[model samples]
Target chain A: EAGVAQSPRYKIIEKRQSVAFWCNPISGHATLYWYQQILGQGPKLLIQFQNNGVVDDSQLPKDRFSAERLKGVDSTLKIQPAKLEDSAVYLCASSLGSRGGSPQPQHFGDGTRLSIL
Target chain B: AQSVAQPEDQVNVAEGNPLTVKCTYSVSGNPYLFWYVQYPNRGLQFLLKYITGDNLVKGSYGFEAEFNKSQTSFHLKKPSALVSDSALYFCAVRDGATGGFKTIFGAGTRPFVKA
Candidate 1:
């Protein structure tokens, strides 16, 4: 099986600009997640999707960050009016889906390294 | 709120020596614990997980973790470490009772193995 795929291995832009990162999950996966990893810290959940419907987004910066997983397959995360603090690695992951309340391990893509100037 | 913690920022050991990375977690319900490895400029790779069976779980790359319920810890251990095993290790946890099934990761521990 192919691993999760992400585009634009690297990105650089000035503050206030807009950027988007794309991700393709593994085949048959029904759960997708977006995470932001800052320097010297762990990856924080930005959003989570079960199929096409959102399961969680409480940690997402709705004012600036937006994400969607259309058709329950691929996902895209957008950051508008990016701030200097927004510079970090954006990771996308997928899992085999939760069954009977048991969570499965997630498969991750290489991730997009975004830099804000 | 559920959380995970890796108390050590880094661990150093010589090749052929045993290595251990400490991890502790807190959650309201039964914990689903996991260990992941991340190389430089790469995404996190799943190494092992402890859902419910034995307290000691074996994983990839000759790694194993002991789940101590009383201690609320899941520490990764590998005997006869190799230089290639040196990398950043992350411990994660999820509360089984939580509806979202969200996973929380620790700060991560970097292990440096020298030959």
Candidate 2:
């Protein structure tokens, strides 16, 4: 199966500008996740989608960060008025879905490297 | 909430030498653990996981991890390091008891294999 696909491998924007990242999960994957990884830090979960509906977004900065996974296939993560601290890599990952009370390991994409100028 | 920790920022070992990257986790109940590797400019790849059954779980690329419940640690180990194995390793944990099923990742540890 093809791995998760993300667009615009690199992006650079001025502070306060808005940007959006796209992600297409592997075919048949029902669980999708968006993560933000800063330099010298591990990836941090921004949102999770179990099918088309959201299962978790507690860590997402609702004021500036928003994500939508319509039809449970493709997702878009948008950062409005991006901040300097938002400079990081945006990663997309998918899993085979949680079954029998167990969650599977996620397969990740190369990710979008974003730079705030 | 579940969490993972990688104490070392980086580990250096010579090629063909044994390598071990330390990881520790915290969870309210049974912990679901995972090990992932990330190459430069690439996404994280799953190397292995520990759900249950055994304290030692072997994974891809000749890697294995030992889950020590008493120590609250699940450390990644490789008998012989290779230059290709040099990359960032991340440890993750999920608390099954928490219906949310959210996974928390630790700060990554970079492994450098000197040839």
Candidate 3:
């Protein structure tokens, strides 16, 4: 089976600029996640979606970050007025697990590395 | 709040020797622990997970992790490491107590396997 897909392997923008990243999860996956990983750090969960509905976004920075998983197949994460701190790798992952069910291992896509100037 | 810790910033081991990477986690309930590996400029790949049943769980690429409830640790181990095993390893945890399945990841540990 094909793995999760993400576009624009790299991106660079000036501070206060806007940027967007796209992701297509593995087929038949019910759960999709977006994460941000800084240099020398582990990936941090930014948002999670179950099917077409959001499951969690507690850690997301609403002021600049917003994401949507419409139809539950693909997802898009947008950063408006990007800050220098937003420079990091944005990752997308999918899993077969659902809420209240046994957890499954996640498949990931080669993330988009963003640099803010 | 659920959290994960990778105490070592890096670990070095010689080829054909055993290697261990330490991980510890804190969660509200029975924790779901996971191990993942990442190469340069690549996404994280799942290695293994410990949910229930066994304390010792085997994962991909000849890797295994032991879950110790008392110490709240899930350490990754490989017998007779290969130079190909060198990469950044991450420890993650998801709190089973909550209905939401938000995962928390640790600050990764880079392992160098010298040949």
Candidate 4:
């Protein structure tokens, strides 16, 4: 099976500009997530989606960041008026499900490296 | 809330020698632990996880982790290290009670294996 796929492996934009990253989760996966990984830090969850509905997005900066998973297969994360701190790797991951029985290990894609000038 | 900690910023080992990376977790109830590896310019890859049953969980690339409930620790280990094993490793945990299923990750530990 194909693994999680992400586009625009690298991105560069000036501060205050807007940018967007895309993700395509593995087929049949019910859970999808977006994370940010700053240099020297672990990936931090930005948002999570179960099917087409958002499960959690508390960590997401509503003023500048937004994400959507239409039809439950693919997702897009956007950052408007980007700040210097937003310069980091944007990672997308997916898991089978998030139910009670058993937790599936999340599979990740090669993230898009975002640079703010 | 659930959290994880990787005590070591970096670990260095000679090829063919044993290696260990330390991790500790805090959670209210039973915890599900995971280990992931990230290569240069690559996304994090799942290494192993400890959900239940066994204390020793083996994962990809000859890596294994020992889960200790008493100590609240899950340390990654390998009998023999290879140069290619060098990478950034992260430990993560989630609380089973909440059913929230959000994973919290550690700062991460970089491993360097010398030939």
Candidate 5:
């Protein structure tokens, strides 16, 4: 089975520029997530989507960060007017679903590394 | 609110020696604990998780974590450290009662296994 796929493994942009990262999750996975990981910090949940509907996005910076999981398959996370603090890795993950009591481990993609000048 | 803490910023160990990375969590109800490892410039990889288990949960790369409810701790351990195992480790937790299922992660700990 193919792992989660992410485009533009590395990206560099100036501060205040807009950037977007795309992710294609593993086939048959129903849950998709986007996370931001700063240097020396763990990945933080930016948004979560259960199919096309969002399940949680409390941590997302609505003022600048936005994500969409259209068609319940692939996802895109966009950061407009990126700041210096936004220079970090963006990780995407997916799981089977939430219906079963079993806890499905999240499979992650290689992630896109963003560097803001 | 749920949170996780990794006490050590970095841990150094020699090959064939035991290695441990400490983690503690705070949650309102039963917690779902998890451990993830990240290599250089890579995404976080799931190692193991503890969700209503026998307290000792073994995971990939010969790693295991002990879930202690009383101490609110879930420490990752490997009996014999391997040089290839050097990487960043993160601890995470989720609240079970609310079904919110949003994970809270710790400030990662970097493990350096020397040859």
Candidate 6:
């Protein structure tokens, strides 16, 4: 089976610029997630989607970050007026279904490395 | 407020020797613990998880993790370390405190399996 796919594997932008990263989740997957990983740290959840609706985005910096999973298949994460702190790896993941009773593992993409100068 | 901790920033093991990476977590409900490995420049790959029942859960690439509820720990272990096992390992737990399924990861632990 094909894994989660992400494009623009690398991006560089000046401060206050805007950038967007795209992701294509695995087929039949109903849950998609976006995460940010900084150097020396583990990945942190930025947002999560269940189909075409958002399930969680409490941690996302709404002032600069936004994401949408249209048609419940592909997602795009956008960061406006990028800050130096936003320089990190943006990862996308997908799971079989909901985050319900049984636990499931998430399939991940290679991720997009963003650099803010 | 669910969170995980990887006590060792790095672990060094000789090939063919047993290797262990320590992990501890803090949660408000029944914990759902996971272990993932990431190679250089790659995204994270799931290794194993402990949601209930089994104390020792085996995963891919000869990896296993023991879930100790009493100790609030889920330490990753490999019986015979291989040079290829060298990579970054992460410990994660679901944010049960908020009654949501958001996952929180720890500062990764780098494993160096010397050949």
All candidates: TM-score of chain A: 0.97, 0.97, 0.96, 0.97, 0.96, 0.96
Q: How does candidate 4 fare on TM-score?
A: 0.98
lDDT of 2 at B28: 90
TM-score of chain B in each prediction: 0.98, 0.97, 0.97, 0.97, 0.97, 0.96
Candidate 6 docks at the CAPRI level of high
Best DockQ goes to which candidate? Answer: 2
Residue pairs in candidate 3 whose N, alpha carbon or C atoms collide under 3 angstroms: none
User: Could you report the DockQ of all the candidates, in the order they appear?
Assistant: 0.85, 0.90, 0.89, 0.87, 0.76, 0.85
lDDT (CA) for every model shown?
0.95, 0.94, 0.93, 0.94, 0.91, 0.92
Docking class of 5: medium
Report the candidate with higher lDDT, 1 versus 2: 1
lDDT of 4 by residue, A1-117 (tens): 999999999999999999999999999998999999999899999999999999999999999999999999999999999999999999999999755667889999999999999
Worst 10 residues of 4 chain A by lDDT: A96-105
For residue A42, give model 2's deviation from the true position in Å: 0.7
Q: How does the DockQ of candidate 5 come out?
A: 0.76
Q: Which run of 10 residues does model 4 chain B get worst, by summed lDDT?
A: B93-102
**A1-117 per-residue lDDT for model 3 (tens digits):** 999999989999999999999999999999999999999888988999999898889989999999998788999999998999999999999999744566888899999999999
Worst 10 residues of 6 chain B by lDDT: B95-104
Clash pairs (backbone) in predicted model 4:
none
List, residue by residue over A1-113, the lDDT tens digit for candidate 2: 78899998999999999999999999999999999999989999999998999989999999999999989899999999999999999999999877777779999999999
Per-residue C-alpha lDDT of model 4 across residues B1-115, encoded as one tens digit per residue: 8889999999999999999999999999899999999999888899999999999999999999999999999999999999999899999998988878699999999889999
Kindly list the per-residue Cα lDDT of model 6 for residues B6-104, writing each as its tens digit. Answer: 999999999999999999999888888889999999999999988888899999999999999899999999999999999999998884445687888
RMSD of 4: 0.9
Candidate 5 ranges with C-alpha deviation above 4 Å: none
Give candidate 1 misplaced runs (Cα > 4 Å): none
Kindly report which residue stretches of model 4 are placed more than 4 angstroms away from their true locations once superposed: none
Instruction: Give the per-residue lDDT of model 1 (tens digit) for A8-112.
Output: 999999999999999999999999999999998999999999999999999999999999988999999999989999999999999987777677899999999
